[model samples]
Target: MILCFALGIANMFHLHWIILFSVVCLICAFIILFIEIPLLLRVCPTSPAFDGFIRRFETNYMRAAIYFAMSAIQWISIAAKRTSLIAAAVMLLIASLFYALAGVRGQGFVGSKTLGGQGVAQMIV
Candidate 1:
């Protein structure tokens, strides 16, 4: 998120590039939302191996939600057509705050010790 914000700030003079970047990010986010998530949900229920794969990666649904929120905010900024860089920066910062809150609430990727320990054991075996 910091990287995206920094890129937006650095390219403030090139609004076209920022807009393009935001579009690309939104595309990737949609791909994950539409394709990857459904596949994961379908496979995770009946496939123990796939469940292990997901656990091994420490996938955080909370973080994914934050990512989706950030992508939506970027599109909103583009649509508003006014100080998009500033708007993106503020929105991304708010997203980061939600990310931190997720960590505090034990919803972060690899944040919970019990889950982290289980992941380590699964990986080792």
Candidate 2:
């Protein structure tokens, strides 16, 4: 991932590279949204319930927002105005916070460890 990221960075200096990176990122983002959601639903059978719906909403929302933020990097790099840079920076930060809070660490969205412990493990099984 780091290597690909660095390569993308190196490509940013050229217009073709920028376009290629944009297309690739967009495709990957779409694939993640299309593929991961069903897998998550399968992994979590209660996904259509009220609480499950809320969890899926937060998770997918943050995931999409983070990808959107990531896709803005090229725009940020090419942006000429200070205001644009600041706006991009702010969006990136907010997206990152939500992404972190979207439960990647297996804890609940708010940071309590109630979702993935032995208790929940037994229920999931």
- Which model scores highest in TM-score? 1
Measured by lDDT, the strongest candidate is 1
Deviating ranges (above 4 Å) for candidate 2: 1-15, 39-93, 101-125
Q: How many residue pairs clash in each candidate at the backbone level?
A: 0, 0
> Model 1, range 6-117, lDDT digits (tens) per residue?
5454545554545665554444444334222434334334466645444442344445455555656565665546544544545555655765676677773543323333
lDDT of 2 by residue, 75-122 (tens): 464544222233334454565565666556555433222433234445
Local distance difference test, candidate 1: 0.49
**lDDT for each of the candidates?**
0.49, 0.44
Residue 104 error for model 2, in Å?
A: 11
The Cα error of candidate 1 at residue 32, in Å, is 6.2
